[model samples]
Target: MRKIIFLLFLIPILGISQIELKGVLTTGNSGTDVWEYIDPNNGKIYAVVGGNGMSMVDVTDPANPVEVSHLTSVPGFDVKVWQNYVYCVTGGGGTAQIVDISDPANPVIAGSWPSSHNIHIDSNGYLYASSPGTTIYDLNPNPTSPTYLTDIGTEGHDVTIRGNRMIDAHGFAGTYIYDITDPSSPQFLTIITDPDITYHHQGDFSTDGNYLYICDELGNHPQADITVWDITDYGNPTKVDETADPSATPHNLYVIGDYAFTSYYTAGFRVFDISDPSTLVLADEYDTSSATGEGFAGAFGVYPSPTTGNIYINDGSGLYIFGFDGLLG
Candidate 1:
């Protein structure tokens, strides 16, 4: 009887330890960053991949992704979607362009901007371009043709929108927060920095908007690559927790509910349990690369679809689709 009880206990523990994102499908052969677009008219889903150029892939079936369109003119290093349009920035600091995906089968360049490294669009349709700094644009009346708004002087690597606040990951300088409640007039909040910070690469806010997670691109090998900050006091942020892996370098991290998913360069896709902001635990991981080390050679981006619970990872080789049923709770 005691042996039976012990076996049952060990079974549950082993199940939890083995829990991870199961690979659902794999398609394509090259991509940099990946973002999803859900058509409001037809309710079909699509994946915008960034790499050699912009590639529009129909992901409605999730398991079988088909390349619907490709725009080779616009260099796609980073990508984002807003409504019916898709925004992409060229690799190695080229330029930003808006692509009309109203018809996913025939995507066309709608507009273009000056040299930008990354781009983002908020819920209110404000476009934030990281052209060495943060350049704001209004996409209200015309998303295809954005109107220049203003510039927030900071060496921005990436910008994220949380409610009415705009957070800029300013590489070596750290993170900057601004009140974008007024799209044109942004009010400076405060800068969050720590002595250990090497490069503030990308960031995302908690679902409840209480904590901020920053991924340091250069911090590697047993260093605090992913830092969690308490942003309840917007003006004065506090470092609450941090985590890292010795084998991989941190790139981008996205917080969805209680879990934090990251695109670890060589380590592939990593998931952390952030139920407690003071202490983060690595819950699961999926290696998307055969090579592993503290270098940039693997996964470049990880996007979790809130609508379908499908995890999308773009690596040096191609795009991977995974599904995690843990989000059902």
Candidate 2:
């Protein structure tokens, strides 16, 4: 069996300040899958270990992150945090584990839901989970005990919730929209399926909810590109722009203000300026050639800390925190 390794090297530019690497958190286990989330209220970082279960770390001190707690309830493959709670979905498990991290150092398992792979939460306190199907849970009644509202089966790969609308990246099923004003009974609004496109992996919406950035994971195909869609009119979505990079297959994306951060498999992390939704321009890119793996090695996720002015990238190796100075500006 071959081993995977991440070689860290810094390149300095005369006029441009390089993004500083704050810390690297590794489990010392080979082939460990890690996903991280930062609490908006506090600059604390939390990560879930895919291969060896989940681990929570207090990254308030970026230089030295302390491992606060670890839960082996299920091998967490994906994680999403909203408010003081962290929701994680396991790889082969049929249930999703919900943890109450109000006390950051001491996290307790609150509840569990069946059949979940990916999840997203809205400002209104609704938990949207995705597996082969999509399910919605109400988190306002009780933070610890979630109320199962409705299960909207739609072959969802990933879900993003904004206001009353929930966008579903339905793998080969394309992107579907649902109106969940009434949490218990969601209405299927529309389905946007373009045959010219390949697999729609993961995406995020603009803060104003005017546009959406969709990433297609099927790079071998010509249709693989980061597509920008105008969703001002939820009933009718229009493709604004589509851009592709020759070196990578975009798996997931993060949109903050006018900048969009993309995690590209094999090609590394690429940054694009989306000041104009219809026309996106490449601003900067960092190649992690050393982070390559056999299957899904490259870059899996990117989390930009709004408070610390730092960006964290997760490859197969571990969670790496980089200070984005020149990259964002």
Candidate 3:
């Protein structure tokens, strides 16, 4: 009884010592993508959730996110915002759900393209969809519809684009980098693989684009390390740093400046300082669960809104919005 009383007292103190939770907003169900877009017309940011069809959130008020419109029955898997329109795929259902967000409050289907697991867009309004292998499309000619451009015979779980450089995390097989300077014909640059990097779940690049930070997932247990690599040289990726949580599996992550906001399935949200490539310092953490021990039952995705540094996360239960106090020591 004495130990129990002491532990209960320590819990709140530990929580208070960690990061600040500004506010959390959730969806009707679990959502994987928190797609943010700035209204070219008004400049107010809206978060489009990809889960059950889609949910439009007014994140202009980041603290109190309100779901103004949603399509709960469609069950969307991934989404990418382009030219004020949303291109999404119905995960297992296979079809693109093109939504027009010009109204913000009420989104209507603009059109549909090839459905995919993951969708990546460039500043040029071109798109790369991970339909297992990659299929490139041109949304420039028609914002409502896409004209198929090309397809790359490669498969991946997720893909990220920076400039003309693109990479696909193929899971267990590692990642492949590509030169997409010409969307009509994307050149495969190289494949990165490491014994510890099997099941390359998700990855993001450093602000300068010289480094690639990749994280393994729930598939390859024990290989939970969020491994870092030096990608200055295209074909050769050199391993640099690695970090992990013994109790939880790391999921999606987004970096803003030198800070990394990562989600640990059972452990909740974590903030890391990546200013120094040699060492990763844990800046703050917020555990989403009070249940004993751990095993994949908490936050799975996190999005750091570009307009406002406020962070948003979605667990299996609901969506949460948080405020990040920059590198608070």
Candidate 4:
């Protein structure tokens, strides 16, 4: 384990916060999305850092994360973990790399894909690679060498799976839903669109799966922050509510239980109490960047670990680990 300089209590740049900065690691490269993986053999948690390339950090100790290994074979703009494997992409034309991380201390590239923009692995161990559009691959038998399954030709930016549902965020096309009960053949459900939608970047479902929350990546667009929809009727999604911080650009969103966590480009990491979708409340916020005005120059990604109870976020500076003590029951 390398010597990790812990920046224990750095104050937030903006409002009072219920979040505490535990530790951080400067990856040297501007960071993007991050994925967590718990080593089954040892039960140690690791954070796969994405950016120009990808690196593995032992976050089992949140106060002192140690960079264990890394791979520069591909530009990792997005990353996801399934079992003992990692799927990553450049969000461009660069080939996607499949890494075997059975040993967190020594990860190795096991295989490759033609290209990918984003990657997601469902509970069934199926890999959904968004290469502008969407392509499904089976990670069964061997996670590294994925077997081609099917393709949803609807061009999109990202894809997410929860239970039997799949949500594909398609910029101006809005968000599309599909029945992924059969991972190989996704049956199109319906497309959720609203006149105010600028860019459907990414989103997550509420705990009950009756509501959907989406984030629009356009910073300057009016009301493009976060939008909520009543997804109880898959064929007819109704826009229920919305919330935004006009000064920042919203990126990705992830939901766990009653809270929705988001990464704002210049605003930093924000947590929303989604118990009432119609009236989402800002539970806690911590500005991770000093740069003012939004143009994608701040927190790039955020991941609230359900297992470790630690929040991981990446900014232009590097990775910041935090613990959120505030939550509205």
Per-residue CA lDDT of model 3 for 1-329, tens digit only, reads: 99999987996677533466766665454557666777888878667776667777777776777887887545467767887788878654356778888887888887876677777788898887774777788889998888899887556677777788887777766788888899898888878888766577778887788888887885444554588888888767888778866677777777677777888777788888877754567877888654323455677667776666557676666677677655332
Q: Residue 185 lDDT in model 2?
A: 84
Q: What clash count does candidate 4 reach?
A: 0
lDDT of 4 by residue, 1-329 (tens): 12332222333433334677888887544379887888877888888888877788888888888888777775688888888777888787868888888887778888888677787888888888875788899888777788998897667788878899998988778888899888888898888887787788898888888898888887365675888888888767888788867688888888877788888888888888877765578887888888777578899878888777778887888888888754322
TM-score of each: 0.90, 0.80, 0.85, 0.90
Model 4 pairs whose backbones collide: none
Residue pairs in collision within model 3:
24-321, 26-319, 53-75, 172-199
Off by over 4 Å in 1: 1-29
Q: Give the number of colliding residue pairs in candidate 2.
A: 1
Give stretches of model 4 more than 4 Å off: 1-17, 27-30, 219-221, 325-329
Candidate 1 local lDDT, 1-329, one digit each (tens): 99999987896566553334433334553558898988899888777888877787777786677878888888788888988888878754656788899998888889876758888888888888874788898888788778899997757889988789888998888898888889788898888989888888889888788888888888865678888899899767999898877878988888777787788988888888877755678988888888777878989978888887777888886777776655544
Q: What lDDT would candidate 2 get against the real structure?
A: 0.68
Model 2 Cα lDDT, one tens digit per residue, 1-329:
12322212223423434446787666522123344556667656655434355667666676776667777775466766666677767744477777777766677888776746777777788887776677788889886667888787657788877777777888888887777788788788777777767777778777677887787777454564778888888778898888875656777787777677777767766777777766678867776546443236667767675655667666666666666664455
